[model samples]
Target: MLFLLSPAKSLDYETPVPAEVPATIPHFEAPRGPSTELIRLLREKSPQQIATLMHLSDNLSALNVARYKAWSGRSTPENARQAAFAFDGDVYGGLDARSFTPAQLDWAQAHVCILSGLYGVLRPLDLLQPYRLEMGTALANRHGKDLYAFWGSRIADHLNERLAADRTPVVVNLASQEYFRAVDRKALKARVVECVFEEWKTDRYKIVSFHAKRARGLLARWAVLHKAATPRALEKFDLEGYGFDAEASAPERLVFRRKT
Candidate 1:
């Protein structure tokens, strides 16, 4: 089973990566790559345009504008950090890639895939540069008026290729709906399973954005540390205070609930 995750908007490029962790190039950043094409378009937008497009403050808009201008065609150790370590948000907070050992990171690199607006799909160890682009962004490109239209079936095709060797070829969807929408379901060749994390709010179990995001990361972390390969193994996930809700789970949707 391959686990899907969403890229965090908040980034941490200041921390030093461990000497043991290695980085690889993103698939979409190859020569004449999709990312390169997208970057070319992003470079055209002025800081004010970016601010309006992404609804950012002056400071944030200027920062990203500079990032777009400074982006290089090639990723280097000096310019990039591993994707898992670079992302810093609620989802990544639970992931806590910093604590992972070299062996665990190696396993995560193969089993985990992070959905991105710019790079498409990123493995845990893929080299990443600092940037802020959400999947829902309406960045017009040759493909269409939005990033989703631009991505089309490319994301699903990539996932299919990666799952070709797997016996079951199951895709565990831990990504937010915005990012997951980029993966064309018709083009994908795997059984997609959605994991729902709910919290006991007031009188019932309800989904909270912050807690759910962190739970997704916790689940992903559990899968990596345990080396969970089968869907059955995932049901056994009981990290943080969460417990699998057998009654609430369906064949395609697995629900985990927690009471705090």
Candidate 2:
């Protein structure tokens, strides 16, 4: 089984990663190809323009502008860190990759895939340079109006390649809607299963953004720890007060609810 996740905007490169988890090269390079073109377009824009485009403060915009300028095509352990270790958003907080053992990381490296605006698709151990370009950004590129247009069928094709190597070849989509939209479902050969995490609110079960995001990471963590290879194994996931709701779940969409 393969898992899909969204890249985080918040980064934590300074935090020391576990010495056992060795960093590897990203499956695809952004600096040399279409991603390079996107960066080129970004370089043309001023910090103020960037702030306006991404809705960032002056300081954040300045920081990203420096990051964009410093982003050389070449990535090394000295210059870049692994995607899993670099990200520190809510989803990543639950993932807590820094605590994982090398063996667990090895399992994750094969099963987990992180979708990105600049990098397109990344494996867990893939080396990444710091930059903030969300998948939903409206940055016009040569392909069309947005990053989606530029990525087109490329991401889907890459997923297919990864799935072809897997025995089960099922995609567990833990990414948010905005990031998942980048993947061309029709182009993919593997069966896609969307995981939904909901909370029992006043009236009924509903998806709370923050809790659901963390739950997604928890599920990913479960998969890696258990070395889950089948879709059925996913339903057994029970962590952080979440339990699989068989009645609420469908074949394509697995629902896990927490009564908190």
Best by TM-score: 1
Clashing pairs in 1: none
Instruction: Put down candidate 1 lDDT per residue, 1-260, tens digits, no spaces.
Output: 79999999889988888888888999998758988888888899999999999999999999998998888778888998899999999999888888998889888999999999999999999999888899999999989999999999999999999999988899999999999999999999999999999999889999999999999999999999999998878889898899999999998999999999
Model 1: how far residue 80 lies from native, Å: 0.7
Residues 153-184 of candidate 2: C-alpha lDDT, one tens digit per residue:
99999999988877657999999999999999
Could you tell me the C-alpha RMSD of candidate 2 in Å?
A: 1.2
Clashes of each: 0, 0
Query: Which stretches of model 2 miss by more than 4 angstroms?
Result: none
Q: Once model 1 is optimally superposed onto the true structure by TM-score, how far is the C-alpha of residue 87 displaced, in angstroms?
A: 0.3
Every model's TM-score: 0.98, 0.96
- The C-alpha lDDT values of all candidates are 0.93, 0.90
Q: In candidate 1, where is summed lDDT lowest over 10 consecutive residues?
A: 30-39
